[model samples]
Target: MALLKRDFIPVSKQQNMKPLHYPDCIHLSERCGCDLLSISECKGESCSFCQSAAQQELSQREWLSILNTLGLEQQKKIAGKYYSGKMPWKSQQKKG
Candidate 1:
């Protein structure tokens, strides 16, 4: 399922211009519907939660949401190809 834009809370930047640090586990917590707060300190890398989220594929609805963020012309072009069955599939055979 695609998460709505409102699902994410707006993160504010600090006065020192340093970006807020997000725990590598936020994606895992997100699956459980946790409203995460911005953290200033993070545990070291090598987090399995982060790694899993990174490898997950976006759903069709999520892809549509992303396409909607593009300009109108670009959106039309992509949607055209998608609806016309011309969108490439990894295992599709190519003709000479």
Candidate 2:
């Protein structure tokens, strides 16, 4: 029921050359053991993360597709957890 390395997400950095920030650092997924992109900062895109057997080529939509493919249960759980039962949230919080 956790978003392990199989659900790793790309880490994005701020605009001022600061460290990358994860919007949801408390979720089970944030603990994913995937290697982060540390060599260079993300341009908000043009970066990627590997989720176990699946590698997302730096598209947020692609990552979400993987979750949806995990099955309806997972998709619902994720949507209820972070999306506020709506489109992706611009802010990260357990709104619903």
Candidate 3:
């Protein structure tokens, strides 16, 4: 008899996949390196919406997900490139 525990209880239907349950498939790009991509590229510089043509850009969640798999130094480099521009983020905005 194996030592691995087996659940005799029937799995509940409530245990369904989340809306964002995307499998980790890897893709390599000259600009972004290896990424777990569903949609191909980032749209309108981090703008995400429903459309085929607008699906080129990576979503914000995808960017952050890719970042989590990266080293600190590489993360810094990527962040630098994106944030260096006129980012509309509140953090980049000056407080008066």
Scored by TM-score, the top model is 2
Every candidate's lDDT? 0.41, 0.40, 0.39
Model 2 CA deviation exceeding 4 Å by range: 1-57, 87-96
User: All candidates' TM-scores?
Assistant: 0.25, 0.28, 0.27
Comparing candidate 2 with candidate 3, which one achieves the higher TM-score? Answer: 2
Give one digit per residue, the lDDT tens place, for model 2 in 1-95. Answer: 21322233445564333343332212213333223644332222222332322223334456655664576676667778787775453232223
Which clashing pairs does model 2 show?
Answer: none
- Model with the higher lDDT, candidate 1 or 2: 1
Q: Which regions of candidate 3 deviate over 4 angstroms?
A: 1-58, 85-96
* lDDT of model 3, residue 58: 46
- Write one digit per residue (lDDT tens) for candidate 1, span 1-96: 222222344345543333333443434343223333343333324433342243344443355456556786775677577656333321221320
Most lDDT-accurate candidate: 1
Summing lDDT over every window of 10 consecutive residues in candidate 2, give the lowest-scoring window.
24-33
lDDT of 2: 0.40
lDDT of 3 at 22: 21
Clashing pairs in 1: none
In model 2, how large is the Cα lDDT of residue 22?
A: 36
